[model samples]
Target: MDMSERELHETFLPPFKATVDEGVASFMTAFNDLNGVPCTGNQYLFKEILRDRWGFGGMVVTDYTAIMEMVAHGFAKDLKHAAELAIDAGIDMDMISEAFVTHLKELVEEGDVSEEQIDVAVSRILEMKFLLGLFDDPFRYFDAERQQEVVMNPEHLKTAREAAQRSIVLLKNEGNVLPLDKNTSKRVALIGPFVKERESLNGEWAIKGDRNKSVTLLEGLEEKYDGSRVEFTYAQGTTLPLIDRSTQKVSVTEVPDRRGFAEAVNVARNSDVIMVAMGENYHWSGEAASRTDITLPGNQRELLKELKKTGKPIVLVLFNGRPLDLSWEEENVDAIVEAWYPGMMSGHAVADILSGDYNPSAKLVMTFPRNVGQIPIFYNMKNTGRPFDAEHPADYRSSYIDSPNTPLFPFGYGLSYTTFEYANAKISSDKFQSGSSLTASVEVTNTGDLDGEEVVQLYLRDRVGSVVRPVKELKGFEKIHLKAGETKTVEFSIDEEMLKMYNIDMEWVAEPGEFDLWIATSSADESNHLEFSLVE
Candidate 1:
């Protein structure tokens, strides 16, 4: 990506800076190149920004075969040159690449590389090993009995369940169709490809996890509601495409004999409510899983259309790794819950949300686009010269003729079983002076009958600057619990640090200008805001 220096520091580098601030122990270099330089061999990134400017003392490691891949990136002539470049760029470890092991010795002997550089890299690795107590006791982490005891202990599972519950985002709930009433909605139909799926529950990264231990959605629901009280029906509406990775060319094909659309519809027709689990299979995402179309894979969309014929309230429960194109589901489905691969406790956590045992408090960290056409969509985007106006449609403006410029769901957006209202937003001062801080506060009240947690978000916009700025940037957020009919005040401290950004000259500074601040629910929220100015 050809990122400008301003964009690199302001947008892309903040997260890495944050990790460095938090004192992360290690960092793995990216496989891709920035501009024309591969990250594994980019001196500007590893040496200048990460080490010199930020003072990140952590060991830097290359991604799997990333050091050797510099040849493919055309940044290096061969493995020896790639190894030399990576080491010179401050890479302390080479993952899955023997380039460093094989070529470093020869390069040093040939005077192409210095012995001191090798010593520095080895010292960093040894420092990390010492910190991990590997030198003190190399076999400390190899206790099989301890590993077996704590691998899936009850306490760990409980924490996993809670984490899974909090990670669930309630995207859309038309007419409050969610929190399925067990007493009223007796016959519940659990339909779709993932009804009893176990292998995909832990997602792509959980290679060591035992799939058999995972509790399926059907199993969780059955355990939550007794069979005597709430009758349950199950149907595999469709089967996911089988991915064969035995050869160099991966083949994805549908199970020839497992289509059960008719049976699923028949079951849905008899049930009062339908909980359809649909999304990409675990393998459809993660490494080497790039796709042009990020919609519900397989015949699942067709299956949903068939189930809609029953006229039952469909609660679409998503299980996937990345943001999906949920344009049709958002419009057609009664309710939508983004339960992104909730690990081993996926089923129990999802069931808790569905049964109203837990109110979802998790907000989306990433923006979900309405369609794949809006691939690079985000909340903190710079308002171009001809910004799109919803009130006044113009062909010259930056927008799509077919769809709105807005996303399906904005960043920091999540719904709750209970409703929240933001009121009385205020700033401690009208003008902020250098070295002094201001408090931005707002009153959040739980208006609904159920008690819930609300993530009060704080966003800021620099109206004018030497360089163009984002329309809004999230500065602070606080997740507070409010009881039914309770109101709580949430305050955020805003200092010059929060306002600092790379100027036109690429120097980090806070320019004196008019700024807009909002203490609201989500990035899309524009209801309550305060205008302030930074003075010289």
Candidate 2:
């Protein structure tokens, strides 16, 4: 948490504010302590920041065993005191701690805690129950017949497929190896540990999903070309350890079997195009599954190395819960599709994107590091006093001798079957009053051969401020669709509200200064640059 107050207000708090604006019901507090105070017992976070500043009227719940673990942080004397601190900090519910149920009553009787505080928590909890219509009919939502009708209905499945397609980010497409014609392919090799699996497709947190009903990649592709001439061959080249759900840990042995490597490479040599599905095992990511090695697990990358010898165009499809280090695959593979555990309809959605039925338009929300060493890389990072220079390399500059100071893929980065070009960026005025609105517009042209969508990103930077600001901050964005050779003008409105930031005095204000604005496809690129000013 090496961030200033301004950084917290500008970067970390926007998404939470957005959820509150959406009328979300409740919020679960984080586990880590802010500064020295445990988040579960931090009055500043729950009371001052969330309740008072943000006007979040919903209930606040602690994470699993968070209150009981306050003793580990040495902030609480014991379980009883921990319970009092948590309740007093505006936590309305304690999850799995039993700290409240055990000690809250005793604390109230001893005058260590007030009954009014308990009443407030109880009222918020009961209010949620009433909002969920539990009092009207407790068993209303438990109808087995209704569950059957809604679980995997055709319409519901279609929506899931569309969502999966939208979430799939096309990372790299060298030589246009994708958009493979299903009819033209004589033989297609679909090799990976995940090719035939069904459960992992639903990802973690899929509590009630029926894995048996979920379609595998092979099933979905076969369904697409059932009446056609394409044939699909698959091989599981490697295997990783399965996860223990009770402990939320992966169970892996010392030895890994690469027995199927020869078969997979053999299939690749004969096939017209090779589609390799490889990445983190379902349980290798997600909650309580942190890993020091963010690279591909097991012999999967080794399998890719062997497949590369065949010299066949490979479509690398990844299923991960977090951004992975793909420095090697980025250089070797022909195309990359990042589909992060694409739910029950994952296969169908991926097939749609790869087959060109759906042009990929989704962009990355997080930065993909070159390797594990570039752990905290992001697009909106500050311009250091000694920024790295490729042309003028020096020891004092902030850069790794082993790697460049850039991410493998920056945030908002994605590829489509088509391409877009940005030009003619214009601002409404060169100078504006402090509290006035300004418009930034740009022309986006789809110059490729197919219809596609482009996310026009608008980034701003205060040239100088009372306090240091990030090198670039995403102010606004618009997603627009354009047919081949189609041109569209996208516009964004910026006001005093967007320009305000917490200054050195800890007061939010907009300083009169020169500002740099950029319109681009991704945050990394400066497709168009314009200068504007705010006058006092």
Candidate 3:
């Protein structure tokens, strides 16, 4: 949330620069202080960087109550002082704070803030309104007729279902227990608190969504099969507690009732295949919702243990916003589906993936640690001076004594219904000039029986630079689909810009050195690699 000037410019600022390049209409200042200064009142960030360097002509808005919080942050004398600092620093609008409305005029009159600065801020806000056509017709986006026609229409629902299906990430599939035979006459048991939760399906951000219209996993399963052929039973194995975000506390009344645990076990025993929909409810993982423990909550894991004793195939379907500590589930569960709050068509998408109507293709964008102890672990992390040496364990190099120093799932990690094999990578040239481009290519073959899409990732490491660099960084990626036994070569073009880094002098330049490039499935899977050199 916060970083030094160099780290901010080198890492966090790139995406913001890209957004400005695309002509985004507005930008919001962060709530946290960047370095030492509060982001809402940072002159360096607003004036020197965003406005002057990036040439962002858009309006800069403060996050909710950020201006007022500046006083709480001890940076401002009071609400009036906060408003003056924010305006002079380039914030155009105060969101929910009303600091500007209460204090800006007085500040200008007192000669503490220039009237010209106020005019500039007001001009940006008016320009955005003009661009949005709100000046001509304030009700342009508030049409009831348009809302009735477009909202939750058939086309929109189809797109939502398709998008939900694509968003799913299949975490584990032991012996290919998933894609169960829909035609077979089998008892399919769907168990958990999340199975029929329509209101929690959209998660926290969907404040205006119609919860009644959203389909649940139970509803989707029923629609997928004929009632006569397939038997579906649902049991609320555990309940989730309602959390108070501000206080980080739960009510005694909201504590889960484990009375349904025995019923869930009984249902699992009678079923041929079990799908346990387990995870944090809508309240457990979003904004302001921090957890000291990242494991399955309440009696959810105990419920799974009871279901597993039935000696039937069990698939765990998770629905949480953040990465969970699935070390136990990873060992016991036959298969796992990460159906992260799949919105309006949550049920349909889960049914599709479970029934094999759609092959799972989405990759995990963030790294999943083995436990909370590895909280800050990431793929692009730099190798420290005494990095963990597996071969020489007694050397006392950097490592965890209790657990292995590796993530449960590395960044860019995902699985498809079909398997893909990566061959040795090759490059167009051994050496390229600073201004020239080099091509890296690798052959990927669909080795499994099913056709599927794979996201081929390209990563590289500068062997040596003026300053230490990350072990590897993702440069480019492409998603491609192939039939079974088909082989296709994926290529990525690399130039000096792609390899450039902020050196000791903080100048973005590609130093003359060898680069080790890998073209493979994920950051951890670096078996297929090639080397190249950059010339002056």
| Number of the top-ranking candidate, with lDDT as the measure | 1
Please state every model's RMSD to the true fold in angstroms: 1.5, 1.8, 1.4
Predicted candidate 2, C-alpha RMSD: 1.8
- Which regions in candidate 1 have their CA more than 4 angstroms from the true location? 246-252, 255-258
Q: Please give, for residues 363-443, the per-residue lDDT of candidate 1 as tens digits.
A: 999999999999899999999899998998887999998888999999999999999999999899999788888998999
The 10-residue segment of model 3 with minimum total lDDT is 244-253
List, residue by residue over 102-199, the lDDT tens digit for candidate 2: 99999999998999999999999999889989999898799899988987799999999999999999999999988877667467799997788787
For candidate 3, write residues 1-536 as lDDT tens digits: 65655677767889989889988889999988877789999999899999999898989999989999999999999999999889989999999999999988888889999989988999999999999999999999999999999998999999999999999999899988888767778888889988887888898888899889899888898888755477888888888767765566765657787799899989998899898998887877677888878888777888888888999999999988889889989999899999999999999999999888899999999999899999988898888888987777766688998888989988998888889998858899989998999899999999999988999999999989888888999999999999999999999999999988888888878899999999979899879889999999
> Which stretches in model 3 have alpha-carbon errors above 4 Å?
244-248
Whole-model Cα lDDT of every candidate shown, in order: 0.90, 0.88, 0.89
Clashing pairs in 1: none
Sorted by TM-score, highest first, which candidate order results?
3, 1, 2
lDDT value for candidate 2? 0.88
Please report how far candidate 3 places residue 280 from its true position, in Å: 0.9
Structural RMSD, model 1: 1.5
- TM-score for candidate 2, residues paired by index: 0.96
